[model samples]
Target: MITFFRSFFNSKIGVALSLIFVALIAVAFAASDVTGGASFGGVGSESVAQIGGEDIGTGEFSTTASNAFDQIRRQNPQLDMAAFDAQGGIDDVLEQMIGSYATATFAESIGLGASKRLVDSEIAGIQAFKGADGRFDETLFRNALAQQGLTEARVREDIRRGLLTDQLIIPATFGAKLSQQLALPYASLILEGREGQIAFVPSAAFAPKGNPTDAQLQKFFADNGARYRIPERRVLRFATFVTDRFRDQVKVSDAEIAALYKKRSAEFAATEKRDVEQLIVPTEAAAKAIAAKINGGASMAAAAKEAGLEPVDLGLQSRQDLAKSASVAVANAVFATAAGKVATPARSPLGWHVVRVDSVSSIAGRSLDQVRNVLENEIAQEKLRQTVSDFTADLEDRIADGASLADIAKDEKLELQVSPELLANGQAPGKPDFAPIGAYQAMLPIAFGLEEDSGPQLVEVQQGKEFAVFEVQEIKRAAPPPLASIRERVATDWALAQGLASARKLADGIAKSSRTPAALEKAVSGASVPLPGIEQIRTSRQTIMQQQGRVPPPVALLFSMAEGTTKVLEGPNRTGWFVVHLTKINRGDASKVPELMVATRQQLGQVTADEYGQQLMAAMKAEVKVQRNAAALQRVKDQLTGRNREN
Candidate 1:
C-alpha cells in the first residue's frame, strides 16, 4: 500500500520581487495574492479567470500558460509539463492573469490611463523588436510574436495593463528609503550563527544482499517506473550553405560601377567636419557664465563641474548635421569659432547652450575616377547579396513544391549532416560525452517542433547569410525504457530503495530516542552495517547565506531546527537520511559591523520600496473582485496535460 506524510518546511524565504512587475506576476503567480473574489454566474462559463468586469477567456489563459511553460523549459531543458504543473506552474499563470486584470480594473476606477502613444513607445523600446541594425523592425517584431504564439492585440493589452499597474504602484513606493535604525534588527538576524552536528545513514550500508527474484524486480520497476523515464530526443538531418557558396559566381560590370558612382556623387563630395564640447544650462546667463570662465582660461570641464553640469562631446559632424542635432544658431556659432576657443552662448529648446570648437578638418572634393575602385567594390558586394537572395528564394520554391532535403542536397552537391538524437537543449542522453555541432544547435527548436511526417523546411541558420534545409528524422517520446532493457539498473536501484525505506525509519527512531549529539552519534555508529563517520559543524546562518543556493539541504535544515533538538532529514534522490543535532545557537551583534549595516540598509531599502508597492497593489486588488470558472479552468489544465485535449 502507498503511504504519505505531511511536511512542514520553513516558509521564510526571499521576497522574490523584481523591478519588472509584469514579469514578476508571471513568475510568482500567487493565487492567494489576488485580492477580490466573485463567481462566473454573470460572466460566461468560457472564462478561465475573471476580474471585476473583465474576463480572460479560456483560449487566452491556455496560451499564456503554455507560453510560460515554454519559457521555464528554456531554462530547465529536461523539465516536462507534468513536473512543471506539480510545482504550481498552471496556478501561477492563472493568478498572474487575474492579478493583471484586477490591477487594471482598480487603476481604471481611479482615472489612471495607459495611452496609445505610451504603449507605442513601450513596444518600440522592446529590444526583441529591434533588428541587426538596431532599429525597430516590424517584420522581426511580427516573427517574434508568431514564435511565441501571441497576437499583437494581446501583447499591446498586456503592456497596457502593466502600465496601469505601474501607475498605481511606482509613485507610492518610489520615495521609500530604509533608515539604518529600521534595518538594525534584520541585520542582526542575518549575522546569527548556529553550532550543529550531522550524522549520515548511508542506504548502501543497509542495502539488500544478493539479487531479487524476477517477480520482485518487476514489481519494483512497475512501482517506480517514472524514476527511469527517458526524456524526448530527436535526430535532425540537414545540409547548410553559406553566402560564400554563390560569391564567386556573382558579376558586376563597369557600367553598374559607374552608375553607382553617379548615384553617390553627393556622398563623395568635399565637406568640413568639426568636433565640439557643449554644456547646456537652464538659463542663458548660466551658459554665458561658463563661456566667460572658459574665455578667462578656466577649462570648460572645470567651469561646468563647479556649476553642477557636464559638457558633452559632439563627435565629428558636418555643419548641416550639427544644425539639425542642436540648433541653427548654436551650430553656426560653433563652426565660426576658432579651434580650441569658446563660442558665444545660444539658446535651444532643451536650455541655453555654451559651445567650444575643439577641432575642425576640411576635405577636398573627389572625382568619379578617384573613387572608382571603392564604388566598384560596393556594387559587386550588393550584386553578390542579390544573387544569394534570389538563389535562396528559388530553393524555397523547390521546397514548397515537394522537394526533399535529400534531393536538394544532391542537386547542390552539398554534404548532408545528421545529428545524434538530442534533447531540446541539444544534449544527447545516451551519449553523455557527446557535444552538438554549433550549426545544428540553432536548428534544434524548429526540428523538435516539426510534425513527425512533415516535409523539409529551409530555415535561416545565420540571419541573412547561412541557410539550412532540415527535417526531423527520428523521435523518441519521453517514457520508461522496457523492464528487460534496464533490468540490472533497476535491480541496483531496488536494493538502494529497500535500504532507504528502512534507513528512514531507523534515522527517525534515532532522532526521537536521542537528545544529545554524543548520544545521536553513538546510535548511528551502532548500526547493523558499518557507516561513514558523523560530521560535526559549527557555523553561522550568515555563512550559509554567503554560500547562496549551494548550501546543502542538511546544513540548511540544521539552522532551522530548534537548539538542543535532534531531527532526521532525507538526502538527495533518496540516497540516504541524515540525523541532525543542534548543539548551540550563537547570535552575533550586528550593531558594530559597518559593512553589514550598509548591506542591510541597501537590501532593506529595496524591500521597503517593494513593500510599499505591495501594499498599494494589495489595496487595488481588494477593490477589484476576482472570480474563476472551475469547469473551464479544468478543461484548460486537461488540455495542458493531454487529457481530453482540445483540437
Candidate 2:
C-alpha cells in the first residue's frame, strides 16, 4: 500500500508538482520569521497565513510562489503568469503552503507526545548521511539539507512528522479489527488457494449450423442488433492554407539568394569543437589530491581510480551542444587547455573536476557547393508556399460559390477521399496511417460536430500522398434492429440454454456420487465424459469445457473456494453447471511483511498529516463563516479563459 502511494506520488505530473510546490514552500519558510522567531533571509515580518502557530511569511510565500509560477511557465509557454496572481492559482499555492506547515506542525506535536529517541535513531540510519566508512557524517547531513534550503531543525521536524503520520495512517486503512466471518474469508481466499486441471470450452464450438433459417437469423439479429448498428457519422471537406505553400511559389533570384546568404553568413559558419575527458570527484580535497597525482606524471586513469572518480570520455562537442551548467567551465577549460594537458582543480556547478583536453578544431567555413543545396531547397520551398496559397484562395472562392469538392479536386488536379465515422479524437475506419502522402487525420471536429447531411465543408487536411480535400458522402445513425426480425436467433439461443442445463445436471449428479477427483472420474467413465487436461489451475474463475458447446461455471468461482472443499458455478449462457473438486491448495506470501513495514509507516504518517489538514481546513472554513462569491469567481474565470483563448 505504501508502494502504491509512493508510486502515485512518483508519477511524472505528481513528482513535478510536488517538487515545485515543496521548493516554493521551502523558500516561503526561509523568507519568513518561522525559525525561533528570527528571519534568516530578512523576508521581513509579514505572514501570509498561519497553521498551528507556524507563520507563512510573504518572503517564504513569494519565493515558493515564484518557483511555482516558473514551473507552470515551463510547462505552458503560452500561459500569462501575471494571470496566475489574478486567478487564485496563487491561492492554491498558498493552500499547499499551509498544508505543508500543518503536516510539519502536527508531526512535531505528535512526535513530541511520542518519543524523540526513535526519531533520532531513524535519522541517523538515513543513508544520505553515511560517510565512505559507513559512519554517520553530521557535516554531510547538514550540508545536504542546507543545499536544499532546509535547516537541521526543519529537516528533523519533517522527519518526525513523516514517521508519526505513517504510524497514524497504517491502522486507518488496514486493521485487525475485522470480524471473524469477514476475516476468515479474506484470509482463506487471499492466503489459501486450490489446484486443479482446466479444460477450456470455446464459445464458437456451440454455434448454430451455417445459413441459419431466415426465422433464426431474424431472431439473432433482433436480439443482438446493438452490435451491428452503425455509429453516427458525417461527411467533411476542407482546404488548409499554409504560409509555406506561398513561400514555395515565390521565386528567389541568384542575386537575392547571394545577398540573403551574405547577411546571414554567421548562421552557416562552422562551430568550434572540443575533445575532452574528466575525472569527477565530490570534494575539493579529493579533486586536489587527484590533480597532484596527475601533475606527478601519474596516468589520468590511475589517478582517477585513486580518487574514486569515473573517467568520463566526453567526445568532440561544440559549445552549443553542452548543457548550461557544464558548458562554460567544462567546455571553455577543455578548449583553452593545450593538447595532452590536464587542468588542475577545475570546479563546475555539478562538482569539482580535473579536466583533460584531447584536442580542439578551429572554426571553418562552408564552400559554395556545400551551401548551394540548402539555398536551392529554400528557393523551392518558397515557390511551393506561394503556389499553395494562390490555389487555396481560388479554391475557397469556388467553395463559397457552391462548387463541389470533387469538382474542385478535378479542376485543381488535387486528390480527394472519404473517411469512415470518426470520433472527436479522429479515430476513423481501419488502422490509422500517420506516414505516407495519403495517410492523414480527418478533421474530427467538423466530421462529428456538424448536423447530418451538412454539405461538404470546404476544409483542408493532410491525406495520403499529399494534403487534400475530403467529401463526406453520407451519414449513418446508430440504431438497433427490432425483436421480431431476429426471433429465430432467440429460439436457437434458447435451445443452447437447455443444452447447458442438461450438461450441468449430468456433472452435478457425477459430483455427488464421488468424494474425490479420482472417484468422480471413475463414476463418470461410462458416461463418455472427457477429463479436463488442466495441470495447474488453482483458482475458480478458470473456464473449462465438459463437452461440445458445454462448460462448467465453477472455473471463475474458485477464488472464493475454501481449502478441501467443492463448489458449483453457473455455466455460460445458462448452458451447464460445473462440479469443481479441490486437489492442492497454495497461498502466496502476505505483502509488505518487513520492508513495506517501514515504507508503510511513512505513508501512514503522510496520510495522517493529510487528514489533519483536511480537518483544519474544515474548522477554518467553519470559523470564518465562509460564503463563496460564485458569480465573481465565474466572471473572473471566464475573463481569464477568454484571454488565454486569444493568446
Candidate 3:
C-alpha cells in the first residue's frame, strides 16, 4: 500500500492535482480567516457553478482567481489586467476548480474517502508547517491558517478530497502501455537518411531590364499601400520622482545601527564545524575491526583500502548537517571526538561507520565594526523607500484633486519633458536618435493603455525607486502617407519583386534540363550570370536543419521526391531559388538501432496514456450534471475587470 501510494503521488496527474491543493494550503498560511457575512455557509447563493449537485461558491472562485492572477503577475510583471482577461486566464482557473470539485463528488459517490488519521499524517509531513526544530508545530500551522483567512476544517476537507480523487484517477490513467508493433513505424521514420545535390539561382542574376519608371513606382506603392502604413503613435509629457534622489537626505545614526545589530546578533555568530572522513562497511563487526586497526598502527587510508572501502570526505560540516546526512548517533559520536583523533565505530542506517576528525573551527561572531558600512547602507535604503512611498501617495492625492501635471511639475521643481511621436514599441519615426529615461521601458504599456480623454495618473516606473505622472499630449492615428513621401522605399521594393519573378522563371528552365549532377553543373557554367556549381553532398534531414546557414526549401522537397528525380523550390525571403536532384534514399532498419526504438516506445506510450485519460475524463464529465450561473459569471468578470462599479 505504501509503495502504491508513493507511485501514485509521484505520477504526472498526481503532481498536477496536488498543486491545486498545495496552492490552497499556501493561501491558508498567508491570509486571515474570512469575516462578516462572507463565511462558507453564507455564500451558497453566490454559486457560480454546480457540478454533480456540488455548489462552487463565488468566494472560493474569487479567491482562486485572485491567487492565480497574483502568481502570473509575479512571473510576468508587465502583463496588464486587460491582457490577462483576453487570454482566458479567468476561465482556465474556473475550469480547474470546477473539474476538481466534480471529480471529488464522483469519488464520494463511489464510496472513496480518506480517513482523518491519514489526512493528519499528510499535514504533519508538509515542510511549510514545520517549526525551527524540524517538527510539525501546532502554533505555526494555526498562525498560517489565520494569515490566509482559512479555517482548519476547510483545509482538511480539501486535502481529503484531493487524496480520494487521486485514488480513483491514478490507476485508470497511468497503467496504459503500447505494443512494439505500434511503435516501430515511427522509429523507422525518425532514423531515415537521404543524399542529394543542390544548386542555388540568385535573384541578383536575373536583374530587371532597367530601373522602373516613376509611373510604375507609384502604381506599386498604391497596390501595397497598407504594408507601408504608419502605426498609431503618442506623444507624452511626464515628470519622474526617483528614490535615489533622496538617499543623501536620509540619515542613519550609530545608535540605531547598534540597536539593530543587537536585535539580530545571532545572525553574526557561526556554528562550530569539523572536517571529517567516514568509512562505511556492511557489518558492525567489520566496522569495529577497521576502527581498531586505524587507532593502533594502520593509517586511516590504509585501513579503509584493506576493507575495500573508499573514504568519503564530509567537508566542514556542523552537527546539524551530520545529523541530517547520516544519523544522530553518528553525529553525536563525531562531535565528541577530539581533532586529529579517530572515533569508535557507530551503527547508522547505511550500515556501520568509522570516523576521523581532521580539524575543527570554533564558533566566532563578527564585530559591529566589521559590518558597519553594510548596516548603514541598508538603513539608508529603507528610509529612502519609505520617503518615496509617501511622496508618491501625496502626489496621487494632489492629482485626484484635479491638479494639472504641468502645474505639479512647476510647483515641485521636477523635470518635465515631452517625448517625440513614438509607436507602441517606443520607437520613433525613421529610427531617429533619442534617449528615454531608464524607466520608460517599464512605463510604455501603461502609457499605451491610456485613452486620449483619460486624465493624468501616477505610474510606477521602477519598484520602490521611481514613479511617473504622464498624459498624452498628442495622438497620431495609423494611415498611409502619399506615395511621393516614401518614393525611395517603394522603388526598392518594386525592384526586388521584379527580380524574384525573373529568377523563378530561370530556375524552372534549369530544373527541366538538369537530370543529373553533371548536367546541372554544365547549365550553371553556361548561364548569362556566373553561378555556383552544384555539389553532390550526403546528409540527413536532421543534419541539414542543424547547419548554420538558412535551410533552402529544396532540402524538404528532396526528402519528398523519389530517387533520381529533380525539382525547383523557391527560397526564403525571395533571396534566390534552388534546383534539387534526388540521388539516393535510405530507410531505417529497427534491428540495427536499439536506443531509438526504446525512446519511440516510451513516447508513444505517454501519448496513448494522455489520450486515454482525456477520453475517460470526458465520459465522466458527461455523466455528471453541470449548471453554470451566467449572471454570476458575468458579475465575477466585471469585478475582476473593475467594470461592475461603473455599471
Best by TM-score: 1
> How many clashing pairs does model 3 include?
9
lDDT, candidate 3, equals 0.73
Candidate closer to the true structure by lDDT (higher is better), 1 or 3: 1
Candidate 2, residues 506-532, lDDT tens digits: the string is: 666666664566765565554444434
Better model by TM-score: candidate 2 vs candidate 3: 3
Worst 10 residues of 1 by lDDT: 1-10
Model 2 alpha-carbon drift over 4 Å, by segment: 1-185, 195-250, 267-274, 277-314, 317-338, 341-357, 360-364, 382-413, 419-465, 468-473, 479-519, 528-553, 561-577, 582-647
Q: Candidate 3, which segments miss by more than 4 Å at Cα?
A: 1-183, 225-237, 247-381, 396-404, 420-429, 432-437, 445-486, 545-550, 602-647
Ranking by TM-score: 1, 3, 2
Predicted candidate 1 versus true structure: per-residue lDDT over 109-224, tens digit per residue? 98999999988887777776788998889998888766654566666767777778777666776677778878888888788888888888878777889999999999998899
Return the TM-score for candidate 1, rounded to 2 decimals. 0.67
RMSD per model, one decimal: 9.7, 17.0, 10.9
User: Model 3, 434-470: lDDT tens per residue?
Assistant: 6555657766666766667777878887788677888
TM-score, each model? 0.67, 0.46, 0.53
**Which lDDT value does model 1 have at 513?**
70
Q: Considering lDDT, where higher is better, how would the candidates rank from best to worst?
A: 1, 3, 2
